[model samples]
Target: MDSTLPSPNPALLVPPSMPLYDSIRGSIFAPSPTVLITTILVIFLTPIFLHFIVFHSRSPISLPTFLLVGPAASGKTSLMTSFESEPGQPPVETRTSQTPHSLECFVPASIARTSEYRSAHDPSLKAHKRFLLLDTPGHGKLRHIALTRISSTTIRGVIFVLDSSLTDVRVVAEYLYDVLLTLQSSATSTTTQSKKLLVACNKSDAFTALPPSKIQKLLEDEITKMRVSRSKGILDVEDDGEGNDEKEWLGEGGEGPFTFQSMEEVGVEIEFKGGSVENGEWRNCLSPWIGSCL
Candidate 1:
């Protein structure tokens, strides 16, 4: 055989293209309406598809929490219902909650102090400005639910709803006293950030409802009495190395009466406001206070 077998026939070396292959090639290169439409759709829609994928992930977003706490029948759940209900609709009926319940709420730009003054329809306010309103059980046995939330959650603010129509307001004051003490101790030990407390006097529509001012006065007097009793008890206990005596006090340590103003020293800013959810009044009134928390 010749050393190179007659240069393997040149025609055999060339790739023989079948008609099917050529037809397929022609269809691809010659853009049809369908191909053009598909290409254009991909080019235009890819970005939006990616945005949906990246922004709308399965993970949950964390929002600042505002705790609602008070004695039983103080309308904490009713307040929660008012916030969760739609505007212009009747407020939802609420039962006494045994566990913590959280609802999402957004403060509109028109009244939100955290947001710049702008049109209420601003789109940015819909997403960035939101918070959770956490309602806790008010019964004595269940109140630990609220206290645990205070210690564990990133509590942005606290709403202490008190029934102004209560015949014996001392119970309300005692509960509030314990809550304030808890907040005060946390404020002292924690960083310097000031905590906001809104003393919402609910059921102001009642005939015998007390005004915010009167409620504040009564609470001050009751807290003063509480401080005295607690101080005496502290003295009765064995004196450990810890400063239990000073820690037990609510406001400025002295013989003077305890006032809400005195709580400022412990980084607690207290505000008293009266409103009745039944009258559809407090929602708007609370906007400014909630805004301040943001």
Candidate 2:
């Protein structure tokens, strides 16, 4: 009837004593050979385990390298600069003005995403490959050298930038024709593989000064004409039906069809500050063309 229960049994609450704490303390103060070996093993294996988790866990895809070529002041440098960057990635930029041209190394974010996609979708696509953006100087004299470099390098694609403020369409046409000729003549072994050509009509800030519709029409016309020319060359070689002649003709002055656009009409925004143009931004504009080629 008492409201309070009888006092709890104190003896039952006490734990049975073993020298567990003392043993642990002794081991810490004066470690045994097995303890030392175990500690060393943990120290050595921790990093290896972590590395496998971090790196080998994700399957990556082989990203293709791209070449950036255009006339001087055609915004190639700016385009390269505007390419998406990943944290902790090294910046890529051109170093020398002449001689042995070298591309600055940087990891493109697009390639990273593509690699992630491959890992998710296809296991066979897993491989460690990089998208190297090779920036070549656009001087007329170095055109041959640039072409040679592009040909020798395992280029996956080419981005050709063009200025759209030309007064005469014929001049732009000639320049484009020359670029096509160079690409066709270059010593690339893959004949059937189609290389991507992205024509960025840069300096769209001059859109207000020039008629946008006219610029677009001119660029479209030039692209159509170039494609027609390439098709005609392909047909001519087929008609001849001689392999050597076909190869010769293709190597002489034939190129794949190029996707062209005026950067102004394409809505490429060029940022400027302190009397200097900053980076340019094209929102997924080149993705379709790149996808087709890749």
Candidate 3:
């Protein structure tokens, strides 16, 4: 036999490397139709499934309710606009100008969007609660409907707004005091927990903008004075044999102690910003007094 045995058959010899075209042909020609179809289906269905999960996860059991009360031109509309424009959502404007007597405007959230809106905001903030911003006509007429909506069990909070630059602060102050008195009386009668209140004290942007510290101080002083005035009224009621010092504090007539606790203790945040409408310097001013209700 030849030393190499006629060299191992040439056909049996393996090539050192495969050609690029061969690799390309192998990959392109053997297409896996089943795998391709499965991948396509997954891509199409993933987003729909995820969206369903998110929607159901955030759905609310019940919506929260909030009340908005203030003097005319108190920026009730503007404040609502701001809240509507809060983060992670589009601005939703829902206003009903013609409310019943004693109530100027009633803005309710759209029932269709109630769930989506509430779910986006932080739950701890209780943003999902249905908010009924009731813009009362004025102090003169507030008494009529004061008990109707103000005292409702569903009401979670009250926003009392006023104009900062008004010549006579007394008139606005008196109106708020009356409203508070009514609320206090109602709370006493009902076993349901009283709703929290927030005073906006809006339009700090008028004249020179008041620093938050200064605004806080003014609010504290005003609340203290209101409390003193209320305490005096409480003292006037002659003590009854029942020994219930609070029992004398009946009806909406007597002024209960005013507190800075709402401003001091609750989620009563302040913003010294300009009005949305031009030429309207003191559009809205919510009282810091409402904070006590929270």
Candidate 4:
């Protein structure tokens, strides 16, 4: 036998690779019916798909807002400053806020996103990490601003900050009573979206500071007294008063002390959280609570 076989046929050799551009053009312009149909479909439908996926809603979603309201010196401003700063940074001292101010902040993994909440299957939809934190002045005169903002459709939550060591619980409880009442007034309809309340008992590090549970109990008792006092001050309206009583009450119409649970019946859910703003302990409790809301 010959040492080497006859030379392999040239036809068995591989051809040189075609340019990418030429390959694409040939694929698109091929005479096969399926290729033509696919090409036409891509040309006509790609833009439509892209238009919906990319440019459907250009304006940003109205971010979910959380309003911080409390009596002055209760650490509302300090807490806001703490929230604005990164963790482990020495606590920043905040001046008493003179006017209502809003800070757009990102709470990673705790934001209430419109995309995922409103339209889940959308490619543009996602649970964003953005929310608006509105810190209102806590002075008695400035509280009207907070009350008005509470009714806003944009606000999803409220934080009522109170000094846990305050000598006078009545005043703080009075302020909280007003807030809970405001939340309850609109909580009537089951169809309406209810707002959440977080009673932040700040300064829990102080020796005199009461625990969150004690603070909640004191507030409930004080509100019970107020409801009775106000119920006695009823005044009559003369102009065809449509067979209505002139008194407004908080929680249910029972005789016992008003509990935060009563508010849930009307849709306003209340949570009591104790934290030391001086040490930035609030972030731990708040992160989980906000995540639950989302």
Candidate 5:
């Protein structure tokens, strides 16, 4: 017997042709109308489809959190209760608290999630984006509670609740100065996203209550004064060799008066919103994230 078998026939090796083969072969060489349409659709739709996927994947894996901090009797507790209350139920009674209390709250359906896409029904929206809301004692002695939490990585934002009718604006501004300054320090070392701060002017219904915009102005003026005083103190310490190691200004340094907008330079976004927590006006005025972060 011969050692090698006869060579295989090239004719037998060719693939069998099917009914659709000629048409597909023809389209590959010169695209038909259907092929051209499909190519055009893919070219146009691919970017949009990829964008949707990218945005959808960015939904936060862990629950976002917000901390409530302000002067004592600023109604932080009341605001928390008002937010956590079930729809149609009477408002929850609130009292002064000495310790930080945290509760889970869901975003209102009316508030859309940033992660949502147009075609996608928004699972994040439907789930209402559960978040943690921590109410910390606002007492001067107890302020460390809120300020300490500000450094935690889990805290996504801060709400500085204040009595709009406050007789002395310095008290509110001082506490806020501490909060923002702490946030400014934190923003320095952390590479994480910037934190948001909302000045919630509570008790909007009070006759003496200042509008949130006015309150914002008062705070800016007071903080500017505080910054100047602090700079002088830092200079004194530096001269004495006690030493200043880092920048302490809350925002940009300029001869001009300070504004809340200045905090943006330090990665803290500030907003002023006034509402009567007593009457549920917060639902209409507070940030949508406030509802999302119970």
Candidate 6:
């Protein structure tokens, strides 16, 4: 019973810590097989895994495009400007656009996204509905851009804006007829996706502006005439031995009025909604309609 118990065995004392250099040298030169294999695997596979993730995130998705087409001075640019701007701000006046322009837009959660009524200030709604709004030149000469997009782009919808207050509806109707004809002709093609057309009767705030229903009827009458006139022209071409494609007709093969309903056969749906962008009246109807298409 010595007080210190014979100073405990010397071997029982803790060993000194390994030197830093020795530890480093041993780890480097004498790593176990599992550690060596793991290091090799990580070094070889890290770049591959990173590349896959980066490429996957960067891969392009076929974005749904909504085409805005109409005759010149139809407020297409104004509407485009308004939709892209912050809410409640007046739309910036834009001159007749001679080229195609596109804007990124989001449908609010109140619409096709969540069905829950999200306030206009809801920040989270911005992430849910995203699409591209492609504004094509409304000029007669520049319409080829719109047609090209229709053929090449994965279109979700078309907004054909026209002034409903104008007394002479033929010009608007004629342009619409051309656009509809193009869509109808391409509907059967394998490359084109089926799309809906929304005929927006702009300037509905004017006293003379026609209601959407009336505008629809007027367009129907004019399109019927256009069908007849074009058929005669095609016949004339045939008479000259330079026949054209019969598929260019706007509606069903008959003498009946060329109603928008007839476009369903060719996979085009037609809808008419009247609103005045000048008064900020269209966003409620138009935004939801666009979201549904996406």
Stretches of candidate 6 above 4 Å error? Answer: 1-53, 56-58, 113-127, 191-193
Q: Which order, best to worst by TM-score?
A: 1, 6, 5, 4, 2, 3
Better of 1 and 5 by lDDT: 1
Q: Which candidate leads the pack in TM-score?
A: 1
Q: Is candidate 1 or 4 superior in TM-score?
A: 1
In the range 1-294, model 1's lDDT, one tens digit per residue, is: 557655578777757876688888988899789988999999999999999999887677678889999998889888887877776677898887788888888776545665667556777667546788999888999888887677544788899998987677788888888888888877888885887799999999999998999889988998899888888777667465444556677777745798899899888899999998887777788877888777
| Each prediction's number of clashing residue pairs | 0, 0, 20, 0, 1, 0
Q: What's model 1's lDDT at 152? A: 48
Q: For candidate 4, lDDT tens digit of each residue in 85-187?
A: 7886756778888798887766554234333364445543343466777999988888999988887878878999989986788888888888887887756
CA shift of 234, model 3, Å: 4.6
**Residue-by-residue lDDT tens digits, candidate 2, 31-126:** 999999999999999999999999998887544566767676665665565454332343345343444333334342334434545545565454
CA lDDT of each candidate?
0.82, 0.53, 0.50, 0.78, 0.79, 0.81
lDDT of 1: 0.82
Instruction: Locate the minimum summed-lDDT window of 10 residues in model 3.
Output: 283-292
| RMSD of each predicted structure | 6.8, 14.2, 14.5, 12.7, 13.5, 8.6
lDDT of 1 at 232: 74
Check candidate 5 and list the clashing pairs. 107-292
In angstroms, the error of model 3 at 136 is 1.7
Segments of candidate 5 deviating more than 4 angstroms: 1-62, 108-113, 118-124, 291-294
lDDT of 6 by residue, 1-294 (tens): 557655677765746554677888898999989989999999999999999899988958866788999989988888877786666777777898888888887775556645567677777665657778888898888888887777555788889989888577888888888888788777766555576899988989888888999888888888788888888888888899987777766666746778889889778888999887777777766987887776
**What C-alpha lDDT, on a 0 to 100 scale, does residue 79 get in candidate 2?**
56
Superior candidate under lDDT, 2 versus 3: 2
lDDT of 3 by residue, 1-294 (tens): 557545587656756465676777776777579867887899999999999899988956533345666676666665655443433343345453435322222222222233334444544344222234455444465435544677666565666665555445556565565556556655656666544555566665577445444544565456456656655655665343323355333222334443344422222222333232222332223212222222
Which regions of candidate 4 are displaced past 4 Å? 1-60, 110-128, 235-247
